[model samples]
Target: MSQNSLRVVWVYPDLLSTYGDQGNVLVLERRARQRRLDVQRVDIRSDQPIPTSGDIYLIGGGEDRPQRLAAERLRRDGGLNRAVANGAIVFSVCAGYQILGHEFINDLGQREQGLGLLDVISTRGEGERCVGDVLADIDDRLGLPPLTGFENHQGITHVGPNARPFARTRIGKGNGTGDGTEGAYNDTVFGTYMHGPVMARNPHISDLLIKLALDVNALPPVDDRWYEALRNERIAAATQPS
Candidate 1:
């Protein structure tokens, strides 16, 4: 990795890519290249040692057992924590989102340790699993459009004071705490429950990561007509009156 090229690490794909989460990294690479920025996309498996030099790291949804295993390896690996300490950006979803936090309930119905990068915690919510299309308003300060994605999880995440709510749930259970919140974020890291590869449905979030990682105020614009169309359709479907 060099200063001129952005290195994006896809962490533990062998374990955490239960959803089509690979699209998040793909979208980021595409958007960066659209600006003529060089990108090195690295796919790191669980057995390999994680590199802390990557500019961005992406983790994705997984089953409970995989989630537990990934979390444990990440903690022992220590690379993610060191990377975050050095100001690397992280974006994770669902199970990966939970792994970024202090703790989450795992498959054995036992509390599992997390990366402790985010202040949030995940606990099993009584009743049915939260599943379906979701519509959320990204934090007003971010100035991004409504975030649209799908959700399918049984854990309810509680955002702690150290982090800000990534979005307000407009049409789904979201964090499942009934507080109208969706995810959690600090300055360099963000966690979300939404899947649909997220970045494909909301390109702004991906751009946000690029801007933050590069310390640039703006990115060169790329055509987003198709993205807008898909976003509008998804948002409409998620928010439609039942």
Candidate 2:
């Protein structure tokens, strides 16, 4: 990792400014700084050229209308797909997640086409919000702690035949009732409903993403030492929830 050369882009307006989604960008910036990596932030909107490539791409959650608008703009731009093809690590949360898929049905009787960057599909929300702590039992390869975060979305996501469920919800409605699904992950992209600026305290996941981006870009992974200390702290926090 160069001491001053990591480029990260966040898709704009169509982006969800609410719910502290920008915090994810801040988290990545801080973590990269700790590792001596320079972080550059960019925002792409309807009129701008979607960056051809970046180390990471982040889109935060938003209301249904904005979600639809963002999805439409992205679909029109077609640059998002191109960037993904060029090997950009993409992470979308809540509405952002929905927009990445083939389609999403909102609480209203409306259907919006997703960017199809991901294989998962989402159905119309049940008007019931799933807001609470989310726990996912990810395997060791993911190198993540059992996570706890809040969910406040009404959409019921269904993983497509080609997708993988990232986590199972232990405290809120995930994929289905009872044995509900939580989050989805494919290649280097991850979609989850957890908010509270999830990435801030979840540096392990951030590291995983940074590593994935570097790997996809054919760059060496970020050194483990910078992330190890934070991972241990998060693990301890997970084990003893306050």
Candidate 3:
């Protein structure tokens, strides 16, 4: 565990990558390189044993059956819980978000157990799928930029008192029918439904994760003017009057 080296565990990509969530890992790798850090990505599949510890962990969206299977595998493995206890930063998206909770209602209308990593629960909605661009305000204490990403999910999540909402939604449906809140957060663990491989669009979030992984309060700056401009443009379009 050298200070310059970071180990990132990509958890079950084969099962939970329906929304191109691997791009989130790519964003983290690229950001670490920009800051002269060495990043090693470990992909944990269904057949493999999850590493006991890592600097960061990424989990992605998935279909109903795969999500259930992945959740069961993770629960049986027990490595992720150890890593989280050791302060690893976890970023999960969409179905991954749901699976981290105590339980999630599947597409078949049956309740399934989850990993119980986050103090949250998810249930299917009755109307149209909540799919579209999303805008959210990050916690001010984090010093991160406002978040913008694409969300496509039907599970309405409710955060418990032990955890906090990751962000407040400004546009589009978030956790529980766009109740002005987006995701769930507890310590270094983050669960969100914003799926455009979220980190790719929100570099500050990536940096924040990196900071946690490295156990540092600050990181070397990287110019993101282009990304900022593009993100702003997209946010403007998404927020426009319909």
lDDT of each: 0.93, 0.73, 0.87
The TM-score-based order of candidates, best leading, equals: 1, 3, 2
**Total colliding residue pairs, candidate 1:** 0
Q: Which stretches of model 1 miss by more than 4 angstroms?
A: 1-3
Top TM-score prediction, candidate number:
1
- Compose the digit string of candidate 2's lDDT tens values, residues 20-60: 88888888877777666677888776567778668788889
- Model 3 quality (TM-score): 0.96
Name the candidate, 2 or 3, with the larger lDDT value. Answer: 3
lDDT of 1 by residue, 1-242 (tens): 34357999999999999889999989999998888888999999999999999899999999999999999999999999999999999999999999999999999999999999999999999999999999999999898999999999988999999999999988998999999999999999999999998999999999999988988888878999999999999888877775
Which runs in model 3 stand beyond 4 Å of their true positions?
Answer: none
lDDT of 2: 0.73
How many residue pairs in model 2 have overlapping backbones? 1
